[model samples]
Structure formats: C-alpha cells, structure tokens
Target: MSLSRNILLWMSENRWMKERIPKFGFVKKAVKKFMPGETEAAALDAAYQFSLAGIPSVFTKLGENITQISEAYAVRDHYLRLIDKVANRKLDIEISLKLTQLGFDLSEEETFKNFTAIVSKAKEKLGNTVFIDMESSAYTQRTIDFYKRVKKEHDNAGICLQAYLLRTDQDILDLVEFNPAIRIVKGAYKEPGDIVFKRKILVDDNFFLCARDLMKNRSNKNVRAVFATHDEKLIKRIREETERNGIQKSKYEFQMLYGIKTSLQKQIAKEGYRFRVLIAYGESWYPWYMRRLAERPANIWFVLKNLF
Candidate 1:
C-alpha cells in the first residue's frame, strides 16, 4: 500500500480516532465527500445532477448492522419511500441496500420479509432495479442464499460480490445461474488474510478475471455487470475483455462512487461507455465515509485542504 493509503486505513480503523473525530467537524466535512446532504431531497438533487450530465445513478442509504427487526423494517420503509420518490420523478436511477440493515441479524425469515417489502416497492414504483450489497464473510452465504430467493420473487432485484474473497469465483458461477444483476467490488471491510487474499494486486487481478467471466458467460442479456473501481488499469483491462468477448457496450456499465474521480467518470462517459455513480445518503455514515477515504488517499488531502 502507498504511504497515504496506509494513513487512511489507519484513520478508518482506529477506534479511538473514530470516536473522537465525529465529535468535531470532521464527520460533517467527510460526509460531504460521500453524501450530497443528509436527506432524500439531497439525494434526489444528486440524482438530478447526474441525470442532467447524462449519467445515471444507484442510490444507497449508508448504515448497516441492525440488531432489531423493527429497525430493519424502518430501513425497508425508507427505501420503499425512496422508490416512490424516484419513480414519481421518472429519474434514471436505481438503489442498493445492505442486508444487515434490513434486519438480517434478527432472523432469516424477517430479513426476507423486509427484502420482499423493499423489492415489492421497487417493482411497484416505475420498476427501478434494486441491488443487495454483500457484507462480511460471516453473512456471505446467507446473503447469497437470500439473493437467490429474492430473485425468484422479483425480476428487478440483484446483489453485490467482493473480489477479495476466495470463494467468489464459485459464488459468481452459482449466482449467474439465477441471472441476477451484479456489482463486483474490491471489498471495503477489513478481513483476515486467510479467507481473503491480502495483497492488493491479487485482489485486483481477481476482479479483472471475474469481470471477464461475467462478460463472457452471463446468460441474460439484461443481466448486467457493474465494474466498481477507481483503478484506471483495471478499467482498461475490463474494456479490452469486453471488446474481445464482443459484449455490447450497453450490456454492462462502469461504476464509481459519487465524489471520487469525477473527471475520470466524465471522461469514461465521453468515450461512449455507460457510467453509473453510486450516491450514498443518510446520517449514519461514519464507517462508510471513512472507508471511502481509505480507498483513495487523495481524499485525505481534500479533507486536509478544507480543514485550513
């Protein structure tokens, strides 16, 4: 890792700093990098801006790890409301959700019910797509199983996979059989080296390999893939693979977070490829916001610049 990235990782993982910084104005400023503002209006404003730029979006509310069924259902309700609002505006946007935020820890059945409600809402409101984000290894199997079942009930729902994990190759194979949309990401959570490949180069290599496999083997034409990264070389590799496999440009899209690498995103769009930006909203963003900074250390420079 670069020295800057190492510092970011340290800031993100340091429990002491996490507890202290949010008390200061750091949380507010850090949030502006990832979130437009803390309301649905702020999120919708972002969606409008991206749409106006000819880019599309997938909105997510950034909070997870729910222990209560009621809290999960509340999250479900918020997403359901988001569906209605986005659809009413006829915006070119979709949504992603974390399963744990939907009460996965409470019970499998309850989590499914929450998911069902959210998916149903998405279907009802202008048929926007929904993606369920994959979490840590402890919940990986359950998340995959839930995606399978949810896809059976809803046509527009999907899931995310982390390229860092060892079992992801097989996971992709199994999931493609369901023909659900997928977003492949280099995972953000810190994990033990055993279950996950610890080296950045290996993780990135795995991501490229998976992107190729998806482009080559996905059965449904509309079963799309989102290559979510800021790495230019990785993007180039996927671009080559997509062309080599003769996958139509519209069959897949490039994805990046909202505030990182705006120029790169625009350039990719200008080059005639579809780009979708992930816009995160909500007040519970300390963990998620920190991870975003860790992914690219330049974000820390931005933070520091504003501090003075």
Candidate 2:
C-alpha cells in the first residue's frame, strides 16, 4: 500500500480516532458522499433510486464486532425488519453483513442462529443470497469455515473474499466444491507483508487472475462470482478476458461502492454486464469511512473540501 493508504488504514484501527473522528462536523459531511444516511430508510430509498437506473444493490448496515449479545440480537431484528422493508418497497436489493456484527466474538452459537435466521428469511422473502462480509486477517479462517457451514445448509448464502491475501487463491480453490457466490475485493486492511501482497500491482494482478479463475467456472448455474473493485485496469482486463473466453455476464458481476465512479457503474451496466452497488449505512461509520479513504486516498480531498 502507499504511505497515505497505510496511514489511513492505521487510523481506521486506532481506538481513539474511531471514537472521536466521526464526531467532527466536516467528517460527517464528507461521509455523505459514500453513504445515503445512517438510517435503514435512507438505505432503502437509495436502493430504490439505483434500481430505477438498471443497477441492483447490496445493502449492509455498517457496524461490526459487537460487545453485547443483546446488541447482536437487536441487529438481527433490525435486519429482519430491513428485509421486510425491502420486500414491501419491492426493490431489487440483497443483504451483506459481517459475522462479528452478529455476536461471533461472544458466542458462535448465537451468531450462527442469528445469521441463519436472517438467511432463511431472505431465502423466503427475497429469494436472494445473503453475503458474509470479510473482515481483517485474524477472522479469515473462521470466516471461511463459517461460510462453509452456512453453505451446507443454505444455497442462498454468499461470501466476500479479499484478493490481497496471499492465500486467497487457495481459498478460492477450496471453495470450488461449494459453488459459492464469491465477491472478490482488493483488501483494505493493514496486514503484514508475510501474509498479504505489499505491492498494489501484485494485488491487481492477483485480483484479475482470481477473477478469471472464478469466471472459468461460469457454466455452473449456481455460481455467482462478484468482482468488487473500482480499478479501471483490472476491470478492462476482466472485460477483455470475459469477451475473449465467451463468458456470459450472469456467471459473474461487477460491484463498486455507492458514491465512487458512478459513471463507470452506469456504463458497465449499459454495456450489458451485471453490476451491483454496495450501499452501507449505520451509526458506526468511523472505521468504515476511514477504510474508504484508505482504498483511494484521493477521497481525502472530499473530506478536505468539506472542511472549508
């Protein structure tokens, strides 16, 4: 990662900044560029608007790693209601969430219960897959295992995998039998060079390679591979490869964040590729917001502009 990105990722993990940064007025203003609002209603409304533009969306409320089991339960209930709202609104939206947000640290059993319940609800109501949002390196193994367990019971279960991890290629191979809906993203965390690619070009190369690997399994009707990034070069490479190999668009999709590269998102959709926007909202926006800037430090300009 670049020095600016590394610093932003470190800031994302700092407890003092996590507590205080979102309290800044300009920071809050800047975050609006990425998130619709901190409310479920705002998320639903944003999804509705995106749907009109021929772009579907994945919805996630942004808090994670909760301390209390009750807090986890409340989150579960919130998602259940959000599912109901999505159904009522008649929108083309799916859900993504972190396992830690559902009490994974406190109790795996409760986490399993809450997650599977939400999955079952989505299966029934939306007929859609619920995604497991991947976190930092520490949770990687447990998350893969979690996805395996969820996949065994639910066909509508999906997962996010990080391309920057050196082991992701292996993880992708291990998951082939499950025929997973894998959303591959260029990782944003501050992991060690021993475990992850320290250079951006290597990560980009690995992302395209892994995406090509996923696309090769395109004939599998159940496989739903989502390449999640805004890297134009990687996107071009994937597009060329897809066309060269005659891969159908349904075999995979492109995903980007809500505010970044809106024009590219529309152009991709117009080109008849499957595309989805990740729409994140919630009160716990500090760490997530920091990572957004880390992903592309240029976004710091937006925050700086807000300051004036």
lDDT of 2 by residue, 1-308 (tens): 68998899999989998988899999999999999999988988888899999999999999988999999999999999988988888888899999999999999899999999999999999999899999999999999999999899999999999999999988988898897999999887889889998788999999998998877764664678899999999999998898899877666789999999999999999988999999999999888999999888999998999999
Which candidate wins on lDDT?
2
The lDDT for every candidate, in the order shown, is 0.83, 0.91
Per-candidate TM-scores read: 0.92, 0.98
Q: How far out, in Å, is residue 187 in model 2?
A: 0.8
Off by over 4 Å in 1: 1-19, 219-222
- lDDT of candidate model 1 versus the reference: 0.83
| lDDT of candidate 1 over 276-299, digit per residue (tens) | 899998877777777777776667
lDDT computed for candidate 2: 0.91
Off by over 4 Å in 2: 218-221
Per-residue lDDT of 308 in model 2: 97
TM-score of 1: 0.92
Q: What is the lDDT of residue 185 in candidate 2?
A: 97
